[model samples]
Target chain A: MKMKCTISYDGHLFNGYQVQPGKRTVQAELEKALAILHKSEDKVPVISSGRTDSGVHAAGQVIHFDTPLSIPAERWPYALNALLPGDIAVKTAEHADDGFHARFSAIKKEYRYFVYTEKHPDVFKRHYAYHFSYRLNVQKMREASEHLIGTHDFTSFCSANTEVRDKVRTIYELDWTDTDDGLQMRIVGSGFLYNMVRIIAGTLLDVGTGKFSADDVKGMLDAKDREAAGRTAPGHGLYLWHVYYDN
Target chain B: MKMKCTISYDGHLFNGYQVQPGKRTVQAELEKALAILHKSEDKVPVISSGRTDSGVHAAGQVIHFDTPLSIPAERWPYALNALLPGDIAVKTAEHADDGFHARFSAIKKEYRYFVYTEKHPDVFKRHYAYHFSYRLNVQKMREASEHLIGTHDFTSFCSANTEVRDKVRTIYELDWTDTDDGLQMRIVGSGFLYNMVRIIAGTLLDVGTGKFSADDVKGMLDAKDREAAGRTAPGHGLYLWHVYYDN
Candidate 1:
């Protein structure tokens, strides 16, 4: 049976969504739990919608896995949750069509970056938000965000060592608003290259700080060079808010 | 100068209030920070109104420190906050009369404990709440709270390891209220011995669960033995709500 699972996780303790040696990764933890249920070391290969870096949390990370054991879809969430760690939770699980792939079938993904401009450190909110005591001009950041929308070669806004040849990606939406805790920057795109969302967030922050004009993003995009992008924001502030898939 | 400081801290990372060797205690952290400020090998001891256990948190824990430094007492909050770690912050600092003391001059201390009765684990709230899936009777808990008013020899409620010779402590008020998030137990007392608040909370929880009657608390208090009290609740769900002091 092929199962589609929606999960939420606190990424601070994890190396990343991907499994790596000597580090406690989210995939490895989930895989270990799945192995216990199936009674086989290689019973399932869990596939996620995308790789989220360490300290990048998720509210809804879509994933899929195949199992030889027969288990009701309704019981999947409860069964998996019992074996998973405290930081991760299986929110929903159901049977997906045979052709569906958690990654390839996705049409769009939404990411949110949270930042707070407060002098005192928020004791309860430190894990979920990045504190930037410096005052920011949101109007300028919004102006810069407009230039980031639409289809363009985002090579300038990606990590230098990214292997993807197609640097072109369509950003469906880019907006920023003041939330109760801090400023929340939301970006929805068909696909993203390595560090694209974080780079965009950093660039917007630069604009907000008046370090660069909104037009600078245009020049950076025109250059199509990784060095042209702003500094990458720390992964802790980023969240995989949601995933959109074609019906 | 006598300085009054309001400290906010995440208690999960420390071993309760008092300074102890080989342990990371809140008092030790503050003393270390104060030592750095004073440029003295000798630690600056700060007296706190509330001495909470490990894993408990405080949004505002009142404390007083005496120092010969010429800095105004009003600047103590900002100055201490600048030197403290990210986990601890001094919210406000004020000058207190020489007669003022955080512990002896305190009139009342309020504590709040949160419990979640839902089946699902709240990832965001895991550190601050105790999760139990059982159905709780709030009315029963509230009714039971009435038995815990005024002064009493709380030997049954206090832990055996406490160094305090007298078991008599006045609990001014104790009540339970249901919130959108969970059940909140609030207790106001002149002072609390080791594990007294947690034991009271545990006893009230027992009443909520129909294991004991509200009137049974009378017998428990009369017993004056630690074994007669209900189990001690975990420390994570408790918070030092507020402290009132007389100048």
Candidate 2:
């Protein structure tokens, strides 16, 4: 049977979402837990919507795995949570269609980046937000993000090491909002390139700090050069907020 | 010159607030940072409003120390923050009058306890909140908290090892509010006995869960026995929210 599960994790503890040899990764942990449930000596492979870098959190990461056990769909989360570490939890579980794939079938993804603008970092929220001690112009950042919406070539915003040749992607939504602690940037898109969201956040921060204007952001998009964009934001401040699938 | 400072700390990394012989503690860390600023051979002693237990946090803890150096009051926070670990930060600093003392002059203290009632704990807030899977009756908890307000002998709520001769304390406020993620209990008091707040939180949780009633809470207070109250709630969920002084 095919099982679909939605999980949330404190990514600070894991190396990343991918299974890396000798490193503690989320995928490795999930596969191990599933293997334990099945009493299998061999490692079980689970597919996730996408991989998140180290120290990046996820509120609603979707994954799917094949299981031989006959446990009810709803009970899978409970069983997995009992075995999972304190930082990782399965939020929901259900049986998926035979053709369903966590990654290939996903239609959209949403990501959020948090920035703490206080002089002194918030002790409690330090782990979840990047403490950027500079004053930000929210109006300028909003205006800059407006230029980033819709379909465009994001090569300037992607990591230089990415092997994927396609730089074109559709950004469904791009906006920023003020939160109690600081500013939060919300971006929904058809897909993202390697380090794309963080780079976008960094670029917008530059705009907020008066280093760049809204027009400069558009110029960077046209340049399609990684050097034209701002530095990539730290991974700790980014969250894989949600993944959407066309059912 | 005497300096008064307001600080906040993520207490998960410290053994506790006090300076234990070989343990990593908040006081020790602060003194170390101070010594670095003074470039002295001896550790500088710091006086805090009160001590917090291991795994507890503080949003606004007051402290004072005498320094031979004459750094401006406003610059002290920036200096100390440069040396202190990421978990601890000096929020503000100012010169104190000769009569001012962090502990002796404190007039009020406020504490907050967070309880995550979700079946699966929130990954992001796991460090700041206690995961309580049981359903709670908010009204019952509120009703029980009312009996706890006003001046009372808090012997039943104190730890067994507490050596303080006076068990009487004035609780100015005791209230609970439902939050988006969970329930938060806010308590303001003139002074708190050792483990008093945790015991109160645990006892109220018991009342909310139907293990005890509002009247039962009153009986336990009158009993004045340590075992009469519910178990002490874990330290991680407790936050020393604020410390107030007449100045």
Per-model lDDT: 0.88, 0.93
How do the residues A1-247 of candidate 1 rate in per-residue lDDT, one tens digit apiece? 7999989899888999999999999999999999998888564689999989998899899999998767888788889889999888888888999999999999999999999887767776677888777789999999888898999999899998877898899999999999767899999999989999999998889888988899998899999998887889888889998999887
Residue runs of model 2 more than 4 Å from their true location after superposition: none
Q: Mind giving the per-residue lDDT tens digits that candidate 1 earns over B11-115?
A: 888898887789998898899889999998997988998677889899779989889898876677667777887788887888888899888888988999889
**Per-residue lDDT for A209 in model 2?**
90
Docking quality of model 1: it rates as medium
CA shift of A185, model 2, Å: 0.4
Q: In candidate 2, what are the lDDT values of residues B1-247, reduced to their tens digit?
A: 9999999999888998999999999999999999988999998999999899999999899999998888998899889998999899899999999999999999999999999888776877777888888999999999999999999999999999988989999999999999887899999999999999999999999999999999999999899999999989999999999999995
Scored by lDDT, model 2 comes in at: 0.93
Each candidate: chain B TM-score: 0.94, 0.98
Off by over 4 Å in 1: A213-229, B71-83, B137-157, B160-183, B207-229
DockQ for each candidate?
A: 0.51, 0.76
TM-score against native, each model: 0.87, 0.99
Which candidate achieves the best lDDT against the true structure? Answer: 2
